[model samples]
Target chain A: MLSKKVILYFILITGGIITLAPFVWMLSASFMYDGHANVYPPRFIPDIFTLTQYEVLFQRLDIGKNFINSLFLSITVTAVSLFFNSMAGFAFAKYRFKGKNKLFNLLLSSMIIPAQVTMLPLFLMLKSVGLINTYMAVIIPGMANIFGIFLIRQYVLSIPDSLIESAKIDGASDFRIYRSIILPLAMPILVTLAIFTFMGTWNDFLWPLIALTDNSMYTMPVALANLMGEHSKDPELMMAGSVVTIIPVIIVFLALQKYYIKGIMMGSVKG
Target chain B: MRIRYSAPYLFLTPALTAIFVFFFIPVIAAFVISFTDFDIYAINNFGTARFIGFDNYKALINDQLFWTSLKNTFYFVIAAGPLSIAISLGAAILLSSKLVRLKPLFRLTYFLPVVTTLVAVAIVWRFIYHPRFGILNYFLEFFGINPIDWLGDPNWAMPAIILMAVWKNFGYNMIIFIAGLQNIPEDLYEAATIDGANGWQKFKKITLPMLAPTTLFISIITMIGFFQLFAEPYVMTQGGPLNSTLSIVQYMYQEGFRWWNMGYSAAIAFVLFLIIFTGTLIQFKLQKSPEA
Candidate 1:
C-alpha cells in the first residue's frame, strides 16, 4: 500500500516538474552570461548570474521600443474590442431584432472556418487601405472577434430585461441605459473579457507577423521570433527576450486568473 | 417591451462592421483571388492579376511542398491528438481518485502549461530539444540510451514537435475532463463497488460510459485546435529538417508572405477551411447519431 502511494506521488511530482522545467530553465538562463548557458551538461541554474543580456536586449536590440509597441497595441485592442463586443453582445442577448437568430447562428457556424482562411486577402485589403505596417492593421482585424461577442452575449443573457425596461420607462436614452445600467451590471464579465482580449493580443504571433512588416511596429512575440533568427546562437539574449514577451502575460494571468479560468469553462461548455 | 429596431442595429453596428470588413470581406476576397493568377506582380499593380480560374487549386494538387505540409499536418494531428486526449484522461482519472489529495495543487500544476504563452514555451522547448547540450539528451544518457537529435534530425523533428505539443496541451483537456468527471454521479461507482468490481472494472463499466459526451466534446475541440498547428513549428523548427514539420498554415504563410504567391496561398487557406469544415460536420453528425 505504501509502495503504491509512493509510486502515485512519484508520477504526479515528475509530471509537475516536467511541465515546469522549461519555464524554470528559461528564467535561469536569462540571467546567465554569454556562452555560459551552452554548457555540455545543461545548467539548471546559472553559476555566475549576470544582467548583461537584459541590458543588451533593452539598450542594444531596443526591445523596450517593441515592448511599448506590444503594450500599446494590446491595451488599444482590449479597450476597443471590449466596447465593440459588449455592445453587440448585449444587443444580441437582450434586444429584439429581425433575423437575430439567423445572424447569430451564421456567426457561430463561421467560427469553424479558421482565421487563416482570411489572411491572404485581408493583407491585400489592409494594404489597399494603406493600413499595412500600422497599428490599425493588427487592431482592425481583432476589433470584434465572433468568440468575444459570443462570450459577452452569454454573460449578458443572465441580465434581467426588467432593468433595461425600467430604464426605458424612466425616459433614459439607449446609450444612457447601456452606460448606466447594462455596463455596471456586466462589469465582472467585462473585466473577464478584457483580460482575455489583452492576453490574446499581447501573445498574438502569426497575424502580427504577417501584418506588421516594419520592425519599429513589431509586437513582442513577432520581435522575439525575428530576434531568434539573428540571435540563434545567443541563448541568454533569446531567453531575456522570451522573458520580456511572457512576463506581462504571466502577470496578467496571475492577477485575474479566476476570470481566465472561468472563461475557459464557459467556452468549453457552450462551444 | 416596445424596443426600437434601430437601437439594436445601432448597438451591433461596430461589431458587424468590423467583422464584415475584416472577416467576411477577406473571406470573399480570398475566394475571388484564388481564381486569379495573383502573385508579386499583382501586389505592385492590381491589373497584373489574370483570371486563372481553378488553376491555383490545380497547381496545389501537384505541389510537392503542399503534399509535404498536408502529410506533416496529418502526422501531427493523428499522432498528437489521441496522445493528448489519453494523457489528459489518465491525469483526470488519477486526480479524480478518492486516494488523491492536494487536488487543487495538482490541477494548477497540470494547468500551468495550458495558460502560459505558447510562443514563449516553444522557445524554451527548442532549447530543451537541442541535440548537443539539451537537458533531454543529458537525461537520456542516464538510461544508457544514446542522445538522439530531436529537432535536428528529419525523421525525429515532427515527433519532437508532437511530443512538446501534447505536453503543452494535455492540461487543458484535463481540466475539461475533471469537470466531466465531477458531473458523474457517485451512485454508479457505489453500485459497481457493491458488485465486487475492482478499480479497473469500475472505471471501465461505470466511468467510461458516463464520460462519453465529455470525451466526444474534448475530441472535437482538440481536433479543431490541432488543425491550427502553426506557432510550435514556427518557433521550434521553422518547419525544418527537410520540411518535415511544416504544417499547412506555415506552408500558406510561406506562399503568401515569403514568396508573395497570393493566389496560390489563398487556395491553400481555402483547402484548410474545407478540411476543417468537413471534419467538424462529421464530428457533429457522429455525436447526433449516437444520441439517436
Candidate 2:
C-alpha cells in the first residue's frame, strides 16, 4: 500500500514535468545560439546565453513592427468588439421587442457553423472593398460575434429587469441606461469578454495570414509563421519570436484568469 | 404604446449590421462562390468569371488531396474526441473526490494549457518533438524505448497532433464534467452504496446515467471543435510528413490563399460545414433517444 502511494506520487510528478517540459525547453532553446539547440544530447540549460536572436529578430526580421501591429490590432478589436457586443447583449436582456428571442435563438443555433465556412467569401468581400491588406479586414469580422453576444446576454439577463424598469421610470434615456446602468453591472462579463477577445485576436493566425499579404501589416502569429517558413533552421530566433508572441497573451490570461475561467464555464455550459 | 421598443432595435443595429455583413453575408457568398469559378484571375477581372455549377465540388470528389484531408480530419476527430472526453471525465472524478487535497491547485495546473496561446504551445511541442534532442525522446530512452518520430513519420503525424490536442483540450471538458458531477445528488450515490454496489458499479449505474446531458453536450462541442483542426497541424507539422496532418481548414487556406482557387476552396469549406452540421444533428438525435 505504501509502495502504491509512492508510485502514484511518481506518476503525478512525471505528468507535471511532461506537461511543463516543453515550455521549459522553449525558454532554454530561445537563449541558446543558433546550432546549439539541435545538439544530439539535448541540453536543458543553455551553456552560453545571448540576446542576439532577439536582436536579429528586431533588427533584421523587423519583428518589432509586427509586434506593434499585432498589439494595435488586438487592442482595437477587443475594445470595439466589447462595446458593440455589450450594447446588443443589453438590449436582448432588458428590452422587449418583436423577434428578439427568435433572432437570439437564430444566432445561438448557428454557432455550430465553423468560422472557416465564411473565410473564403469574407476575403473576397474585403478585397472588393479594397480592405484586404488593411487591419480593417481583421477588425471588421471580429467587431462582434455570436459567442460574445451570447455570453453577455446570458449574464445580463440575470440582472433584474426591474433595475432597467426603475431607470426608465426615472426618465433615463435608452442609451443612458445602457451606458450607465448596464455597463457598470455588466463590468465583470465585459472584462471577461475583453480577455476572450484580446486572447483570440492575439492568437489568431489563419485569417490574418490570409488577409494580410503585406509584411508590413502582419500580426505576431502571422509574422512568426512567415518567419518559420524562411528561417526553419533558426530555432533560437524562432523561439524568441514565439516567446514575444506568447508572453503578452500568457500575462493577460494569467492576470484575468478568474474571470476568464468563469467565462469559459458559463459560455460552455450555457452554450 | 410600444414606441419604447424601437430603442432595442436601434441599439441592436450596429451589432446586427456587423454580424450580417461580416458573418451571414460571407456565409451566403461562400455558397454562391462554391457554385462559380472564382479564381484569382477572376478576382482581377470579374468579367472573366465563369459559373462552374457543381464542378468544383465534383472535382473535390475526384481530387486525391481533398480525400486525404477528409481522411486526416476524421482520423484526428475519431482518435482525439473519445480520448479527450475519457481523460477529462477521469480527471474530473479524481479531482471531485473528497480524497483529493488542494483541488483548486490541481485544477488550475491541469487547466493551464487550455488557456495558453496555441501557437506558442505548438512551437514548444515542435521543439519537444525534435527528432534528436527532444525531452520526449530522452524520457523514452530511459524506458529502453526507441525514439518515435512524432511529427516526421507519416503514420504518426496525425496521431501526434491528436495527442497534443487531447492534452490541450481535456481540461475544458474536465471543468464541465466537474460541474456536472457536483450537480448530481449525493443521496443517489449513498443509496447505491447501501444497495451493496461497488465503486465501479455505482459509477456505471448512477453517475453515468445522471451525467448524460452533460456528456452529450461535451461530445457535441468536442466533435465540432475537433472537426475544425487547423492550427495544430499548421504550427507543429505545416500539414507535412507527406500531408498526413493536413486538416480541412488548413487545406481550405492553402487552396484559397496559396493556390488562389477561391471557388474550389469555398467547396471545401461547405463540405466541412456539412460534416460538422451532420455530426451535430446526429449528436442531438442520440441525446433525444433512449440511449441515456
Top DockQ hit: 1
lDDT of 2: 0.86
Which candidate leads in TM-score?
1
TM-score of 2: 0.96
- Please give the distance, in angstroms, between residue A131's alpha carbon in candidate 2 and its true position after superposition: 0.9
Model 1: per-residue Cα lDDT over A37-149, one tens digit each? 89988888999989999999999989999999999999999999999999999899988789999999999988888899898888888898899999999999989989989
> Which of the numbered candidates is closest to the native, going by highest lDDT?
1
Worst 10 residues of 1 chain B by lDDT: B283-292
What are the TM-scores, per candidate, against the unseen true structure?
A: 0.96, 0.96
TM-score of chain B of each: 0.94, 0.97
Give the per-residue lDDT of model 2 (tens digit) for B80-199.
Answer: 999999989988887787655677767777787877668767777777787787778888898998999999999888878888898888989999899889999999999988999998
Deviation in Å, model 1, residue B77 alpha carbon? 0.5
- C-alpha positional error of residue B252 in candidate 2 after TM-score superposition, expressed in Å: 1.5
lDDT of 1 by residue, B167-245 (tens): 9899889988888898999988888888899988987777887888888888888988898899999999999988989
Chain A TM-score across all models, in listed order = 0.96, 0.96
DockQ of 1: 0.74
